[model samples]
Target: MAAYAGLAFLSFLWGSSFLLIKIASRAFDPFGFALARVGVAAAAMLMTSAVSGKVWPGSRPGLWVKLLALALIGQVIPFMLLAKAATLTTSAEMALMMGAQPIFVFVFGRFLGSSDRWTWLAALGLAIGFAGVGVAFWSPGAGGGAHAVLGRAFALAAGVFYGTGAIISGAATREIGAVRAVTASMTISTLVLGLIGLAFGRLPPPVTLLEIPLGPMLAMGALGVFNTALAYYVYFRLVHDEGPTFASLNNYIAPVIGVIAGAAALAEPVGPSAWVGLALVL
Candidate 1:
């Protein structure tokens, strides 16, 4: 029961992340937004590790290299992509697009020499998932336009990066504990994104920050602390207790919440096609 409860909470945190992204993006550009999300998460995770006396991979160059790759693929790239998508698409649509992640995970796992054998049902699911993506893209929802189509593409691509990162994470998590792995990777992501933000002049000036609305600032704080940091902790705990298969159930449940939250809270349109596509994707 506790495990199930944790799963439910985890699903809510992840599912509503798209809406938070939409709200937070109003203040920060893609690079700045991604940096803030990962930076806050990194700080939280680092503090947790420190309190627990958990040490990171201190001298292992190879593990550091792998963590760097995970930071870029898992944290940096997908984060920026999703933030960019938030500008062009509705939160609900972005959530639905993420349904493709598991499909990509399965496909990438096969090529990565996973022992899992292929089956007809898996193939059917893949077909259905891709078809659903096509349907969703066929008619962009509220504020539909060429830019929205491009946003959907970015969201889909983010899923691909996420899937690839999940496959790669197995190695890192094995070497270091899940919490430590997340901390190291997110720390690396924070540094990398910080440098990029500085290079591109994406980071807002201090006075400009004062002019930003309170709602968006609060949205960013909630997004980073709850949706990103705490969510990762809950998700890893669920994976440890219930296994990956059960933990992955969030992929199904969260999108429903995303759609509902978008429509109810943000008044984002959810046409018949969006429902049909979401059904097929699930």
Candidate 2:
């Protein structure tokens, strides 16, 4: 029960992140925001891990490779994708697309030799959920435009990456423990994102902290502390306790929270179809 509650709260945290990212993106480009957010998250995790008496694992090439893969797929790639998508679509749309992550997790887990068998009930749920997505897309005033389609595609790609990440994190955490696994992954992600931002010439035309508004800076900090750092801790715990397929259920719950948050915080539109879709997803 405690695990379930933790997972639910984690979903809420992630749901609210869409709003934060939307606000923060006004100050930072996709690469820039991803770099800063993950960097802060890495620092926070390192500090917390030290305070918790969690020691880093000994260097192993294989372990480092796995950690790198987890960092790239889980944090770097998806976060950049979502950040860019936020500029083109409503938070509600991105959240709804992410809600489909469990289906992909189940599929990926099967390919990875997970013994969990798929039943008709799971299929029905997926069908219903996807049908909801289609309804949301079909609704008037729901779709943004060509850019919205592209944004939705990117969001779905992020969801696929997240599904893959969950499977990897489950295995990685088993070997290294959750804190170390997250710490290493976040560290690597921050480094990679920083390099990417530099390569894209983000630094030369840098937008300094003074230039950005206080609201966005605060949002970015909250995103690091609550959404990235604390959320990943809860996520690792859920994956360790319940398995990846179950932990991925947070994807299903988060969109409902996101729709509500988007409506309340950003005054983003929630059309009838979107509401119906959110209900089906829940």
Candidate 3:
């Protein structure tokens, strides 16, 4: 019962992230938005770890390197990609794209030494999933422009990265604890994103921070705290307690919540074909 409840809660956190990303994108560029999300999440996670008396991998440079790589693959790249995608696509479409993550997780797990057995049924599901993506991509009034198409592509790419990261993190969480692993990875992600922002001048200027609307600011706060930090803690716990394959099940629930939230909150239109595609993907 607790596991199921955790799954539902995690889905809500991640599902709502699309809407928050859409809101935050209005105030900051994609990279800047990504940086802020990670920065805030990292701070929160680190503080939690400290309060809980968790010890970090200070002596293990190799582990630090691994965490850094995980940060880039799982956090930084996907966050930026999804942020960019949010700029070009509806939050509903972006949420649907997340349905592809489990497919990638299944494929990547096979090659990455996961113990899960591959079956013909799983293979067929993968084929159907890709077909659903195609249906969504070519559906009428889907994106409405080439830029939106590109955004869909970016969203799909983010799913791939997320799958790869999940597989890696699953193994990492076994060595350390889930909270510890998440804390370390988020911290590394924050530093890497901050450096990238500095190098590329993507960070929002100090003065412009005051100019951001209250709605977007609140959205970012929710994103960083609930979506990134708290959601990830729950996710890693699922990965540790169940498995990555089981953890990816949240994708199914999250898209439904996201689509409904998008339509209700933002008045985003959801066409019949989009529903068909979402059903097929699920």
**Superposing all C-alpha atoms, what RMSD in Å does each candidate have to the true structure?**
2.3, 1.8, 1.6
Which one is best on TM-score?
A: 3
**Candidate closest to the true structure, highest lDDT:** 3
What clash count goes with each model? 0, 0, 0
lDDT of each: 0.81, 0.84, 0.85
Candidate 2: tens digits of C-alpha lDDT, residues 93-151: 88888878888888899887544556889878876876776666555535556888788
Model 3's C-alpha root-mean-square deviation from the true structure amounts to 1.6
Q: Flag clash pairs in model 1.
A: none
What tens digits encode model 3's per-residue C-alpha lDDT throughout 1-282? Answer: 888899899999999899999899998887888888998898898899999999886657777776877899999999999999998889988888888888888889989977566689877877687677667766664557788788888988999999988888887788888888989999888888778778877777789889999999999998998899999999999888878877877887788888999999998998787798888877
User: Whose lDDT is higher: candidate 1's or candidate 2's?
Assistant: 2
- The better-scoring model by lDDT among 2 and 3 is 3
Worst 10 residues of 1 by lDDT: 239-248
Q: Each model's TM-score, in the order given?
A: 0.91, 0.94, 0.94
- Report the Cα lDDT for residue 67, model 2: 94
Relative to the true structure, candidate 3 reaches a TM of 0.94
